[model samples]
Target: MENHALKSWPDVAPKLVAVAAGRAPADTVLKGGAWVNVHTREVLENHDIAIAEGRFAYCGPDASHCIGPDTQVIDCAGQYMIPGLCDAHMHIESGMLTPAEFARAVAPHGTTSMFTDPHEIANVMGLEGVRLMHDEALLQPINIFTQMPSCAPSAPGLETTGFEITPDDVAEAMTWPGIIGLGEMMNFPGVVNADPKMLAEIAATQRAGKAVGGHYASPDLGPAFHAYAAGGPADDHEGTCEADAIARTRQGMRHMMRLGSAWYDVETQITAVTEKGLDPRNFILCTDDCHSGTLVNDGHMNRVVRHAIECGCDPLIALQMATINTATHFGLERELGSISPGRRADVILTSDLGTLPIHRVIARGVTVAIEGEMKVDCPHLDWPAHARDTVHMGRALSGADFEIAAPAGANHVTANVIGVVENQAPTKALKAELKVQDGLVPGDPEQDVCQIALVERHQATGGVVNAFVSGFGYTGQMAMASTVAHDSHHMIVVGTSHADMALAANRLQEVGGGVTIWKDGKELALVELPIAGLMSDAPATEVAAKADKMVQAMEACGCTLNNAYMQHSLLALVVIPELRISDLGLVDVRTFELTPLFDEGQDQ
Candidate 1:
């Protein structure tokens, strides 16, 4: 296989010197542009950049001396030449596309670099799966640095996974060429409490001279948060409010404010820089999870930068948050994140500063995109057959499996419900009074209460753990089932009708794995993510088309939440607080314990 890793700066330094000294001709020269200097936070006009060996050789007022007869010169026409945007933290699988396809989709939006955590795949296929993601990431035209997944079963004892990422796995991944750091250490409690395994994994990454990502999902800024900070996580992206951002940066961690498809955190958190006057250098921008439809219709990191600006951030500061700040957080500032000499020649030409329009994009000295269209080919991996056949339901399910039997002739009960908050990651733990129907507790659509079941797909045990959920506004006999459940990657079915839920679950099992929606006992939409049941190998536009139909189907079922599919996928994420359902049982995340579904003592 061809190694797509870029040549080191030292390996090509002599050539760079020769080109800068006019001893050799440059391969390409971008002339007559306004440089957005991130290092000094200034826009200098009439700047020209010379490239050699896919690295910047000269960036000054004039590079005419480096230009030879054969050099390819492109006039920038006074466009704002900014460093190519970078996503500090993201997941390729969240796009429902493989690394190659995700890169192809975002490259056109001027995102030349991404630091992705492949933890989703690791939960399903283990180290081999992570290697597949890392190898494919190295083949892309843009930079896709892999973070070794630190938490497979994100909350160790709270949930079960197909595979567990051990300390040895973390050490082994550090040897890979594409690995940048350890992925977000979702096990915050483990770190704070000094669990040997979690500490060992962090130690291995630190010993290897890589960044250790953080995921302190709790809202508490008490001793626990401080202990987690003291445990050696260098950066965190789970901050949702200004206080969270302030606390993180105060503890010397980069605060990565994210704006993904469902996560709207930048607006509330960016105020730490915009209003409170915190140093902008300590704040970074990222998209923790954006699906294919968002990538195709909206933008990638470009969208984040624009959103930050819209949230009252200074244009130059927002650009820095997406570029130099991110690169610096990952210890990659010298290799990328700027248009400086010795850095990779990743630059974006845009006409505006605030409402940025991607006029052209250049990665590794190659023009990869123009006018919101891809200009270069992103290579794909030959996925094995085992990856496509991961859904193991043991046997076909029925309405009986989904039935929530009343506790020995009890007519009424106060049920613990998982409440979905719109455009947020956290859920509210709610209590609702539900009545029994024919010796079984039934979901009431009028009160917006619905049945949620976690069907264990990993072990094929055919185990179904039932609970209740609200805030989807779903009505009628509809059910939605997804194999892309977070952390555990089990099958999560939410519906008002047991039969439709059964139909949805069976449909996903039959198609290997993916998301399926059924209403009135008929299939409404299906976005088949056959690869490990997390992502598809299809093109972004194609997958996005199906995702659009899926969204329409959700709307038709009366779901009013923004990006309800993302909400559905995260119903099983035990790391986040309040309540969630897992293969084990209904999780009370605030206390990190399994709680019963019905509380018969409480009244409505």
Candidate 2:
């Protein structure tokens, strides 16, 4: 079915005029409700909201004149009316679902707007994939704006990708109906260094007067960070601390504190406004990378707002951050931020503001979700079959393929290990002494060190780089493999046993790249993400249930890191600090240099 439900006020205004003048029918009038004014942080009681032509025509203490012979009126019983929640920065692909499925998952959560970046898909399927996401997003029941993917490879020479995004692509996407801005500028180093390509993309977004999203993952508050700020990114969601939030706001960039499925960064950073008392207007709430499990089971933007309230923020202030602050940041304040005139009539009804439970959701003056269930039809996109068969390893891999032969005559060695930082995307550059057994480096469960490998799948290049990682609390013979590796879409397999690791990695390749878990050489769970190796066409419920099993498998393997799968995916990500693995070799993010897996006479 086609989705043509604009619910614009133009069609409803004339009827409201008649109701005001006693001539025609009024659609619906909500009376005796408390207007939770986010702009003033006050609640005005006993107000009546007049609806006509699918818009809120008049809102006051009394709209008796708006009542017509055929008018339908409902007494709200003094329920508080709040604006619909808005997500400032996110990637639908991060939900591991297509735009249609992502919408289906979040629509019930009173989330009406989303600024999504499709770079995850672009890295694997290129421009066509990005356009597919953009088009499908616009067809949803609510506003789903697209930020043209800015960085496909993420780091130009650091890692390889199935496809690359060019400057020309950025310029043309700005003309698309759903295009809102450029995706996160992950090339922060390049921007600071005046890279011509990065500059060109920024210029195109600037020329269109649209927002330029940011991803300055570095904690450096020095000249390098300053130079990146000067490069035209208007907002950032990578900040993890109060200082990171303050630094961005001080430099005229919106500080987006996000609370996603795993990245619980809001509490640490929201202190900039809640305690340090920076202006809350410059802070925005978002879900940087929400998985479908979180979206379907928990709320999206609404969850972020509730998290902010729990983080010592005033409920009203948090709502403003989630709504008006987000709208103003994207230059859409006048259109969607509040209940002001000419704005889209997207509002929510709840009994309390602090524990914001959405009893009803009205978007564009149409009841979309009632009691946390979608009441309207959310259209789906006709996804092509090619998106379901993307995994292409030239051939099946064996246990021998995963074996990392020790250097000639090397028995013991110290190796560079990628340290997993719980609840954060960044890794640590660590040196660990490892034991070499039978000419092969092995992990020490006592040391919490495990083997990490990146198998290059972009060009079918038979390249695999092996490294080490800590902080998983892993204590068994198990492995996990996923194609959801961030930025660079390679397959990263991590395990204590090379046999299980090889089995898990080969399982994904056997069924097309997705996520897989192996325990003592047995397949435990799998999610086939064939769409650019990042998303599945399965329903959110189905995917979340499967992902739950994967999470359970991780737990069964004695892994105890928070959201260990998310930490695993960053194994091949070269942007974040301190150590990472690519198809080439282990990288020291701090020094950007290649490091060996072992040092002489040290078990690493």
Candidate 3:
């Protein structure tokens, strides 16, 4: 019923002619080129390729016999013809765009393939959300592979999701044409501990002969990591260092190095192949979460490829990581990934191997991107009604709602504070002494302490978790709030002033849902993400412009980090690290325990 390229596909006359004459179809022959062959791990000089029906008919020393008088051929002028790049692991929702728009944004970056996990949307909308994403992805011109989201709440019992994804969901999704594998098993602890739900999902993927993606965020690599590997996640992209890469690959897991808007992971981890001299085949490149800002400005897999080369990685090996390694990981090797015969004719023409200056991109034998702009229209999906109105802030909030009340008359008290590092995903669990004023836990400006609130938007149950945070560099009246909190999908609002916090939070709900910047009792900017209170349907450029404005607003508010909003959004994601905030309360992420908002001497 389905044309799984693994079996058979209808051949257009080109392949037959190539097979008969011992030459590939030159429907569009790229001549006078150097083929960067991932299979041979070498760049073959003076090569030619023939394309047919959006598939590579052949790539070798010659394609002359397949070229007819009607065949169109382009002279590469002796440039490097490389396979289109692939993002081994990523989240389409993380870009804050639908799959269709996300495709349009990255297609020009020579990223012909992507292995995406929609866990963010899954947390809010569950199986239906993932299904929508999967169905839409199949319509894209490029290879957009969807991974069945493994963790909906991410941590069962620790947090609650609007909808739950069961093993039945996983088993059913496996039959979909676009599903490549299971999404990152974020519940590594559950898997390692033999939790039935986690095991069931992994089992379904394995049973279906699909890969199980990994996300062991912890740096341990002790019994926990060993037990997790035993649980069967085939590849991991959470590694942030060379040693992390070494450990994952040594345990028979593909180490996926990522580079994104906020995450600078590739340069630090690629040394597994470059310096440690590990087998390059085990490495792959990814953009775990490329925000609209990154896709519009920085480039997608192209950025990773360029960064890998900067890290002293061999250009050929880097291409393999971005192409074949990714395809092979998701059981798509025979269908896509390379410039070999029978594969999707996804290729990029670049003048310099090291620089990776993408001059042209070809997908399925069709020229899609010439220079930097898209040359064709990427189709769109008719998103459902529920997907557009997911923000449900039960009631409006005032300054008092965000205030932290202290025990009767305690003067100075110790409290659990979230300490933000400069540009990392993890947070610091900090215990600090703070002063109390009028039966309230007052923030210490000297300690960079500011208020953080988690507004429960899922059920409109009127729940709010108030806490303290550092590293926003707030010096004046300002606040930032968004419903884009990861994993739990709550509204994370941070501010130096309670008045600004209340205003920012209420404004987001008024706009359905989105991030808002407020300073000096005035609203600075807004990016209306009507969908799930998390993403906007606006074009990538439109989203990027608003995001840039947000960055400027943060700068205006004296908050300084590479991408402070990205850092801000991660503050409530309890699964990743040391500290976080949830609708339940302040979370000690390492222990996954409920920490008191203020010191023991203070009130809850």
Candidate 4:
């Protein structure tokens, strides 16, 4: 089917006017519902909405005049008719499903719009990968705007990606048909330092009159912060505190508070508006990165909206944050985010506003979903073999491949460990005193310290950078490996036993690419993601079930953190926080430089 759903408003204007004026029948009319007027922040009862040509023709107290024999009338029956939810920022690959499957999973939950950054795929497959994602996204019934990735490595010079995005890439992508803007500018330091390439990318986006997604992950609200603001990003989602929210909004940037699968940044930052009384319009709700289980078992934007309400935000205010605020941030206020005339016919029927039970979802003049059932087909793309075959571990890895050798004659060593903060992206640059065993450093399970390895997958060269990490509470002979390592998309293996770690990493390579957990030298669970080694071609439900098993396997290994698998995947991400592992070495993200694993004064 053709996706004329997002066609120009003028193309549908005549049909809409005919239906609005009672001259012609509407395609669909939703009657007897309490309309959520986001424009006025009020709910008007006994309202009817007329839809024609995939757009809202009229929304008012009465639409009986436009109803004809063929016009399908949905009886809302006193249900609250709210605008379809919009995700301001997210990654489709995070769901571990292709765009088609992701859309199918969320449509039942009332999410009709998504502004997704294909940066993960871009990191693995470059511009061609992004185009593949974009093409599939446009085929969905809902809005899934593609943002050209501004940073492929996320932190250039700190991490290397299989494919690097250049300024020319940004400029070229701005001209794509479905391109909305540039993806998150993850190279915040580059922007602050006036890096010519970074500046050129930002300038290209601005010149094309598109939004520039931001990622200022630093906590410093000083000169570096202001300099980043001046570098021309329109919105940011890396804020973790109330001050971070307030600072970005005060600087005319939209503060996006996200509640993803593992990231719980909304509670602290929403306080900026709830407690501090900052303008709610400057704040938006999003799910930056959610895995398949989170999208299927939990809701999408619906979940985020509920969390905001639980945080003392008024229900309508929370809805506004998810809908109009997001649409306005992306300059799509006129086209969506409300039950208004001339906008896309996207609405949700809920029994209650506070505890929103998405009873029905209408997108583009069609009832796409109802009562947790799909009423339409979300199209898919035939992924090529090149996309499927991505994992390239030059040779088979052994137990010695994960060994962290100590200095000569050292019995013990003080090493820097990447400490995982629960439910947050930032890691703590921690120090630990580890005993040397047979001239090798061993992870202390009692102290929650485990060995983490970054296996270079892009090149055939066998490169493994090992480091120590704390906070997973991993015990016994267990290892977790994934090719979905954030930003750079390398293979990350974290385990207490070198044998288990080697087995886990090789398992991923054997299956092309995916996440795997090993216990007692046996494969416990594996979620095969054959697409760029980042997303699976399987259905969302199947993927979610596999991901659930992965989580359970991690828990069985004595590691208990909410979505610990997500934390495991990001251990190799060298962009955010205090410390992280990379192909180069363990990077001190605070200093944006590689630091030595072993410190001075060891018992050598």
Candidate 5:
């Protein structure tokens, strides 16, 4: 892997001083551009930037003195030389592509720096999986920093993962190259409650002088929320409302507003700066989870910045949220994230700020992308066979595996349902009364109720926890199954028909691991994610094309929720409220405890 660590400034200090004094020729001089000075939060016109050894040596009114016979000068007429964007918090696995491919997909959108949490892969393959993601990230041409996963099972006792991440794992990862900090501490309750293991992980990262990421999914802003902020998480991205943002910033935590494939959080949280006039420096922008289709079509950090501006934020302020604010939060302000002297020459030449268009992208003094296309290669890692073959079903699933037997002598029962909220992470805890047929509880499409099953893929326990779910508006005889279930990475199958559900679950096992949709007892669409069943080694466009088909297939089945697949993938995430499914049973995330499937009720 390439070493992306910064060179000692002292080693290049003499050369940089000489360039600034016009005594030495700079390697590249970008002239006649308006420099977006993130430090001063202003745009200076007709500025020139001199670069040497892939670092900016000068950014001022003119670089004529720094230019020599061998100097390469690029004209940036009518362009805003903005610092390259950064995503402060994200997961590379969420893109359903390897780090190389995810970088390829987002580079055209001017994302020069990324802080990725590989916890999703960590849940499946443990520390080795994190190393694979870290190694691959180093091979990319941009600043892709890794955050050692802190929570794999995310919430212990509430869920079970293929592999568990220990405190020793977090401490060991802190010593690896390119590791920025600890990943999101999703067990906010654990931190607030002062769990020894959670605090140890946070202490390890802090002792190493690295940022400790936060994930406070609960809405409680009482003593517990305050305790969590006091527990050492430097920044948080799980804020969903304006109050949440205010509470975070007020407590000295960076409020990271996100706009991902389905997480519509920025519009609500950005009001902290735009409406309530909070300090913009304490706010940041990020995409917590973005699928391939969103990366290929909608945009990445660029999309989030645009949405922030639309929410009444100043264009410069939004850029700071995406760039300098993120860099400063990670203690990387001097290394990257701004068009300043001694910083990496990662910049984007754009014509507008609000409707940002990536006309040219420069990373490490090299033009890596131009006009919505990549101009360089993103190197790949040779994934081991174990990473490709992760799906393990002890036995083939049958229609009977999905059957939910009704309680004896009961004709109707109120079942706890995992309600899918549109474009949000939190689901509604719902109860639906259903009539029992043939000693079984059949899914009621008329009530928007369907069956959801968590098929244990790890250890091949052959444990299938059956429950009910509402929403998705699924009408036809269809079923959807994915091995990418959150936290545990189990196989989650949901449908109205047991037979089709069986077909979908078995098909993913056949493909090693991937998502499959079955209708009328036939496979309608499939995306083969043979790599850890969470991501595909295929090109982003290929994976995105298949994902597009999956979305269309969901729509064809009479489901009209935005990014339904994302909601489906997160159904097993036991950390997020209010309800979820796991190998144990239906979990009321609000209580962080397993609950009975059927509520107490009398038979009709």
Candidate 6:
């Protein structure tokens, strides 16, 4: 396979010098544009850029001398020539599409580079799965740097995964050409407490001279947060508030504010820069998770930049946050982030900075997209058959399997419930009084309380851990089951009716793995993510269309939360607070312990 990584400066310097000195003709030249200089934070007007061997050779007020008779010259028409946008942290599998398809979807949005963590797949298929994603990422026309998954189970003992990522895996991944750093170290407690395993993984990445991603999900800004920062993570994207962003940057870690499909964190966190006057260089922009529908209908990093601008941030500063700041965080500023002479020729043409409309996108000196349409073909990986057949339910489920038996003669109970917070990752731990019916506790749709179960699919244990969840606003007899449960990759079923929940769970098992919605014992919508139950090899547009239908189906079921599907997927993520469910049991994330569903004495 051809190494798609940009050639080193040493290897391309001679050619670049020849082109700049007019000793050789440039391959392409973008003339008469306004260069958005990220390094100095200024827009130099009437500039021209000359490219040679997929790297910029000359970027100045004029590059007429570098142009030759055979050089391809494109007039920018005074458009704002900004560095191609980069997502500091994201997951390709979150889009429900493989790396190639995700690239195809986002390239049109002027996202030329992405630093993706394939931990979602790693939880299901282990090191081999990560390799598959990394290999495919290297084949894309744009830059897709893979991060070695640092936490597969995410929280040890709090959850169980199909495969666990070890320190050896981190060491091995560091040698891969496409690996940029270690994926988000989700185990904040492990780092803070100096757990040998977490420290060893961080050591491996640091020894290899790569960035270590961070995920300090706790809201506490106490000693624990400081200890986590001292654990050697260079950047973090889990900050949700201004204080979180300030603390992260103050500790010399880049605070990556995200604006994904459901994560609306940029507006709140960017205040560290907009209001507090913190240096903008320490703040980056990213999309921690975006579904296929969002990629197709909305934008990628472009959307994040626009959102930051809309949140009372300067256009130049927002552009820097999405571009140079991100590249600098990952140690690729010289190679890909800027429009400098030695950097990869990744540039985007926009008429306005605030209301950015990507008219043209150039990556590695190639016009990959034009007018919100892809101009280049993104190559795909030939996935093996085993990757598609991952769901193992042991046997079909039934209504009885979902029944939550009441404790002896208990008529009512104060149940611990998982509350869904819209446009955020963290959930709320709530308590509700529920009544028993026929020796079983039943969901009350009128109170907006429903049954949530974690069906263990990885080991085919047939173990169903039942709990309660509110805030979805789901009514009637409906259930939604997804194999894309975060961290554990187990099947999560939520519904008011046990029969519909059974139907939904069984449907996903029958189709290998994906998301399925059932209402009144009939299937409503399905998005078949057959690849490790986390992603599909289908085109982004097709997957997005199905995902759109799935969202509509959620709405039809009376779910009023924004991006309820995202909320559903994260129900099993034990890393984030304040409550969650896993294959093990109901998790009180604030305490990082498994708690019983019912409060003591409430079952009387």
Q: Which candidate is the best by lDDT?
A: 1
lDDT of each residue in 300-372, candidate 5, tens digit only: 9999999989888999999999999999999989889899888888999999999999999999888889999
Ten contiguous residues minimizing lDDT sum, candidate 3: 1-10
lDDT of 4 by residue, 80-174 (tens): 99999999999999999999999999999999999999999999999999999989988999888899999988888888789999999999999
Over the stretch 1-604, how does candidate 2's per-residue lDDT look in tens digits?
1224664456555655665564655567777889877777778898877766556667677878778777778777759888888999998888888887888788778888899998888988889888889888878878888999999788877777888999999999998878899999998888999999999999999999999999998999999889999999999999888899999999999999888887999999988987899999999999988887788788888888998998899998999998888888898876687765556777888888888888988877788888878887766778788776666666667777777777777777777788999999888888877666899878788889888888877777677777788988776788899999887878898888888887887788877778998887798889878778888778889999988888888889898777777787777878788888887787777766666776655433
Worst 10 residues of 4 by lDDT: 1-10
Give every collision pair in model 3. 54-364, 414-599, 415-599
Q: What is the lDDT of candidate 4?
A: 0.92
**Tens digit of lDDT per residue, candidate 1, span 284-391?**
999999999999999899999999999999999999999999999888989999999999999999999999999999999999999988998999999999999899
Which 10 consecutive residues of model 2 have the lowest summed lDDT? 1-10
Pairs that collide in candidate 1 are none
RMSD (CA, Å), each prediction: 1.1, 2.2, 2.1, 1.0, 1.1, 1.0
Off by over 4 Å in 4: 1-6
Better of 1 and 2 by TM-score: 1
Give the per-residue lDDT of model 3 (tens digit) for 41-100.
888899988877677776888888778877889898769999999988888878888888
lDDT of each: 0.94, 0.83, 0.85, 0.92, 0.92, 0.92
Superposed Cα deviation of residue 62, candidate 3 (Å): 2.0
Off by over 4 Å in 3: 1-25, 602-604
> 1-604, model 6: which lDDT tens digit per residue?
5547457789989999999998999999999999999999999999999999899999998999999999999998759999999999999999999999999999999999999999999999999999999999999999999999999899999888999999998999999999999999999999999999999999999999999999999999999999999999999989889999999989999889999999999888888888999999999999999999999999899999999999999999999998998888888888888999989999999999889999999999999999988998898889999999889888899999899988887999888999899999999999889999898998788788999999998888888999999999998899999999998899999998999999999999999889999989888899999999989888999999999899999999999788999999999999999999998899998989999998887546
- Between the candidate structures 3 and 4, which one is better when assessed by lDDT? 4
Q: Measure candidate 3: CA RMSD.
A: 2.1
